[model samples]
Target: MDHDLALIVGLVLIILSIPSIIAAFSDGHAPRVAAFTIIAGGALLVWAISSKPGGYTISDVPDTFVRVVARYLP
Candidate 1:
């Protein structure tokens, strides 16, 4: 996938895992799925950043998310 798409997916996965992690903690269970999700998300983020020239910055994330969403949506 392109850098923008990868970035968005990685961020989304990480964001989504937060709730699962919280729920697991509240239930006193292991956050195995959440941990895996975080790992996958981190891997995607690393790949996207390393593959892209000049890399990305905090200021660029909003634009990247908008660009990826617009490209996929009708």
Candidate 2:
């Protein structure tokens, strides 16, 4: 997968898992799925960072997302 795509998916997965994790904890249940999602997201993030010549910075993230979205959608 493209590094940009990996980055986006990883971020989305991690973000989406937050509510699941919170709900699981509130219910006194193990956050098994959310934990897995986080792990997968982390792995993808690592891969994207390592594969890219220069790793992403906080400021570059929004631009990267916009570029990727524009590329894929248009």
- Identify the leading candidate in terms of TM-score: 1
Q: Kindly provide the TM-score of model 2 when superposed on the true structure, using C-alpha atoms.
A: 0.95
Q: Per-prediction TM-score, please? A: 0.98, 0.95
Model 1: per-residue lDDT, tens digit, 9-71? 999999999999999999999999999999999999999999999999999999999999999
lDDT of each: 0.97, 0.95
Q: In candidate 1, where is summed lDDT lowest over 10 consecutive residues?
A: 1-10
Give the CA lDDT, 0 to 100, for residue 9 in model 2.
92
* Cα lDDT of model 2 by residue, 1-74, tens digit: 99988999999999999999999999999999999999999999999999999998989899989988998895
Q: Runs in model 2 with CA error above 4 Å? A: none
- Quote the positional error of residue 6 for candidate 1 in Å: 0.4
Best by lDDT: 1
